[model samples]
Target: MREVEVSEITKEIAELCQEANFELGEDVINAFKDGLENDESPTAKAILEQLLENAKIAREDRVPMCQDTGFTVIFVELGQEVKLVGGDLEEAINEGVRQGYKEGYLRKSIVSHPLKRENTGDNTPAVIHTKIVPGDKIKITVAPKGGGSENMSEVRMMKPADGVEGVKDFVIERVKESGPNPCPPIVVGVGIGGTFEKCAYLAKKALLRPIGDESPHEDIAQLEKELLEEVNKLGIGPQGLGGRTTVLDVNVEIYGAHIASLPVAVNINCHAARHKETII
Candidate 1:
């Protein structure tokens, strides 16, 4: 069996948090570039340009891409054959988040309570999701989600009979209602099937996918493509000033349903799609 140090995982998470905040991923940057090229509105083109320039400045200055910085969310895939040494895995992850947010000069956006809303100074206690995979390597992905787009997400339980059309309609309607709230030219992540919680999990997972990637199943892939076209047709444009670049992409992931239930979730991402991953 392979043995891995928990401290190493902690250290890697810290670095990833900092790196992800400071730099935009190549996939996301390219998405914006492509959006700009296809953007029909002058305002949207300008917004895309500004976004590109901001990314460049953030990297050059070693500063965060956005002031929000975002709440720390980590997805970990641990190998069943590996044993963790030296500490509790979850605690180590939290320590990494604390140190990363503090030392990296990233803003702390987590709160001790959702209703009372007490800011958790260190951005500690990251929202960690761990999965056991069939390998010896531990993979971790950090996605710092800001409030602007997150607040616009929605979830619903559609009747099994409602089918794909229902999902398309709901997502499009929600995006239209969301309009400029999600910062426009967004990335839409849809999760279909599974239970309520599982659907939400899938929705978030969908966001980690590279832009323009689709589900392997042909039907789902077509659904993703169709959703992308429909969302862009909303014309929310860049920063909601009206244009053809309302959505950079739409990603959908699905699982077998209960035979009686269909759960759907929508996770929206702003123009600043800040994420990074590391394996240790």
Candidate 2:
């Protein structure tokens, strides 16, 4: 068995939080370029250009790309063959978030309670999801989600008879209703199947996938393509001012479901699309 230090986890998470906030992945940058090239709206083209420039400036200046800086969501893949040493895993992860947000100068937006509305001071208590996998190495992904787009996300328990058309229609309407609220040129992450909360988790997890990558299953991939086409048809455009580049891409992930249940979820990410992963 392999022994991994918990301190290492803390150290990596800290760096990931800072890095994800400060940079945009190459795939996302390329998507913006492609959108700019294909979109006919002058306003959308200008917005895409500005997004590219904003990413460049964030990377060079080592500053956050968006002012929100977002809630810390950490996904951890723990290898079954590995044993953790030195400290408790959960505390280590939260410590990483606290240090990372403080040192990186990221804005602390997490509240202590839903109703009381007390500030958490430091961004501790990250929403962590851990999975047991085959190897000895641990993989951690840090995704910072802003409130605006998150507020626009939804979950619907659809009838199995409603089928794929029902799923597609719901997604399109959700985006249309969202309009500019979630910030335009958004990445749509759709999770179909699973239970109520599971599908919601799946939707959020789907956003971690790199933009432009399609589902391995042909049928699922086709659904993603169709959803993207229908969403762009909305003409919500960049920043929702009106244009053809409203949706950058649609990502879908599915799980097996029971006979009666067909749960669907849509998680939206703004133009920033900030997430970073590290394996240690």
Candidate 3:
């Protein structure tokens, strides 16, 4: 088995945390440019332009795109054949987040306790999800999720017979209820057919996929297309100022569920869907 150092993981996470906050993905930037070109509302078009400019400035200056530099969420794909050496994996990850947040000058938003409401000082105890895969390489993804869009996320346990129409209605309704609160022109991640908790996890994980990339399954891809069209029709526009670009994209992730249950979850990401990944 190959040996991997926990310190390396820490270093990688620190770099990823900084990079994700500073650089908006090319797919997101392109989406804004496309929105500017196609949106008919002058106000929406201006907003799109500003968004693009903000992204450029963030990258050039190595500064966060938004004031809320988000809670650090890391997705780790560890190779089964590789063994971690030197230290505890989770602790190493947390150390990385602490160093990253402090050194990068990103906002420290995590609280030490839920009810106590004390700050964590540095953003430690990052929300990490680890999976074992077949290869020898480790893949790490850092997605800094902001509170505004996350607050707009929802999950519902639906009857088995509720079906596709039910899901569409629920998602649209959630977006309608959210309105400008989650920030408009959002990316909607829909998870269907899983258990209550699994559905929520899937929805959050679905946001990692690039905006324009459709699911491999034809049915799911079609659903994503339909949802995107329906959501944009809401006239939420850029920053909810009223226009045809209500959502940048709709991504649907699905799994098999119990015969008696059909659970659905929706996770929303704002215009600055900041994430970065590295393989080691």
Highest-lDDT candidate: 2
Model 2 lDDT tens row, 221-264: 99999999999999999999988988888999999988999999
* Tens digits of per-residue lDDT for model 1, 1-280: 8999899988999999999999888888898898889887899899999999999999999899899888788999998989999999999999999989988899988889989989889997698999999989999999998899999999899998998888899999989999999887788988998999999899999999988797999999999898888888878898899899888888898988998999999999887787888877
Minimum summed lDDT over a 10-residue window in model 2 is located at 117-126
Q: Which residues of candidate 1, in runs, are more than 4 Å off?
A: none
Q: List lDDT for all candidates, in order.
A: 0.90, 0.93, 0.92
Could you tell me the TM-score of candidate 1? 0.98
- Local error of candidate 2 at 120, Å? 0.5
> TM-score for each prediction?
0.98, 0.98, 0.99
Measured by TM-score, how close is model 2 to the native structure? 0.98
Error of 3 at 112 (Å): 1.2
Runs in model 3 with CA error above 4 Å?
Answer: none
lDDT of 3 by residue, 100-206 (tens): 98888999999989899999889876899999999899999999999999999999999988899999999999988888888778999999987899999899899
Instruction: Rank the candidate models, highest TM-score first.
Output: 3, 2, 1
